[model samples]
Target: MAQINLQNVNKSFGPGVPLAVNDLTLTIEDGEFLVLLGPSGCGKTTTLRMIAGLERQTTGDIRIGERVVNDLRPGDRDIAFVFQFYALYPHLSVRDNIAFPLKAQNLPTEEVNRRVMDVAERLRITHILKSNPGRLPGGEQQRVALGRAMVRQPQAFLMDEPLTNLDASLRADMRVELKHLQHTLGTTMVYVTHDQIEAMSMSHRIAVMDRGVLQQVDTPLNIYRHPQTLFVATFIGSPPMNIVHGRMVGARFVAGDGQFWVELPPAARQYTQHDKRVSFGIRAEDITVGAPGGAGMAGNVVVREPLGDETVYVVSVAGKTLTAKTPPRIRFNPGENVSVKLDPAAIHLFDGDSGRALLPEGWSKHV
Candidate 1:
């Protein structure tokens, strides 16, 4: 329900130790469902806790809407946090559990009942109203936790992998439910998850973090198709992007292994001028594997994984390994020589040593 902003935020566990969060600055728009995605030890959770006032930031300031809340307690932030581990009162019935937070505030019994049932219905947990927390299924108990948060109708929702404890099928089901729930309510939700799929499907925009630094912030498709860093490129996809050693040859990019052929997009070639030893990156899904002559690079199949929906092929050319994915119904096996072609427009070029993007022609005026 509010926009949040961080300015020069800093946190450290001790002197000389690495900053858990390093001069972090970000903005969360009102009613935006933003997801903080990264692997373990990435400081995403540390950032979330800092926002909630649950973890004190060693430096900088945090603001919700128009007011700075750095001096406020967690309870005063008007935000709800749904963590991985549901902290429900085991002895209480679902109805009582949902009403517990209100009870703590000493609300009248009639008002408590009104808030509890309203939240239960909103989360579709009305049927389990009377069941004790100990008797509920993981998914049901999850709803109770969510309902408890919903009871307050707080200004923001911070969920940190709340679906991590459920079975795969239930987790998937709950993801859909949660998406719909957020859509219907339109609250400012900051969800933290290591699962890229969850982040991709649920977020309006995603902030990717790594080793205490923010990597790239964009829509899922842009992050997938145009990652700003080598780490982001490697971390976001399943099968991952294939990065190869190569050098610029006049207008062409020749693989370092000395047998692969590549053509650069006319637009990308502008950056290749006066630079050699660049890193070429392409996604597994973007590479095309074929026989000796198919208007693409020539290669040989070395291995094949026949997944039900698509086939994954590992190809070899000049002793370099390249992965290509195609429709599962079409199959190819190892030991057979092949040719591959990449979509020139889809290729990404990186500064070999720096792992930073090479600006295309007309991109950097001084280049």
Candidate 2:
């Protein structure tokens, strides 16, 4: 197992140009499953490549478990990488492809055979050992690709969206299999995915990046519950968090339409020395829906979708529109009026002008 540490690591394409990874400092624990999540061109893949020595860092140092590997080549570093596309040798059989790394290391032929059989059997692709990539389905090819990586038994594994091309059913099945494999191997795994669902489900911790900046890093639940910035609050959750322009009315926070009020506790109300134009954030799940009581925020049910397991609602609340998820199969027809309530504990307040979280220095997290 390897614990990765990056100190002031930065990468750029040209001299004196904008950096692709800007002063990123992070510590990934040994045996931890960390997912790097962001949109395309957000520097996630750049960071992963740098770790594998595929790309050189313009500044700072990279350490893998006490050894500073800044000058080492990719082959010299003990890392196994699984790319988005299966990079298997088309002419080689699956067993040969999985045994390639062991051959490179000049290991005993019997040992190579043993490791290949073990991982292929575990991935449920043992039956395809004699087949080539051209004859294998996408899912089977992915397993072979992963088995090839697993054979080396490297200190760490780096996966760059290896399952992005699979079907939905295959994606679900593989996710469960991957999680189990990581646990069984007990290896340090760094995964990259643009899908938040994948990051949320597979990662022990998540690192969120945007515009070449590392925004936040924390446990999946902590990151969702305590987003450090407006960018993270908007990016990490499904259906996204609902944010609206509002003003602080003494102890209460009211929306721009002045129809709804957020009941802030005394501590939360006193969070700011004096900041106006606040941005209020609440997740779709935090909103409780009901028939318009004529007193709450003015809204009409614009759309309702029953997904068998739960109902997704699109409500035009106040001057802005927002989405909510609920389980009650209430027959509130479309265009019917409805009222919405924001849970006190679920409400997140930020500074509108600066777009920064506005709270006491350390007690940003409230009871």
Against the reference, the lDDT scores of all candidates come to 0.85, 0.86
How well does candidate 2 match the true structure in TM-score terms?
0.93
TM-scores for all candidates: the values are 0.93, 0.93
Question: Top lDDT: which candidate number?
Answer: 2
State the lDDT of candidate 1 residue by residue for 1-367, as single tens digits.
8998999999898998888888889999999889999999889999999999989999999999888999999999999989788888888888988898889889999999998988888888888898888778889889999998888888999998899999999999999999889989889999999999899888899999888888888889888888888888888898989888778887777786556657676667777764487778889888877657787867888899988788999998666788888887766678877778786667878777777767442342331
Q: After best superposition, candidate 2 residue 138: deviation in angstroms?
A: 0.9
Q: Candidate 2's residue-wise lDDT over 45-116, tens digit each?
A: 999999999999999999998899999999988999999998999899999999999999999999999999
Angstrom error of the Cα, residue 315, model 2: value is 1.9
Off by over 4 Å in 1: 255-257, 359-367
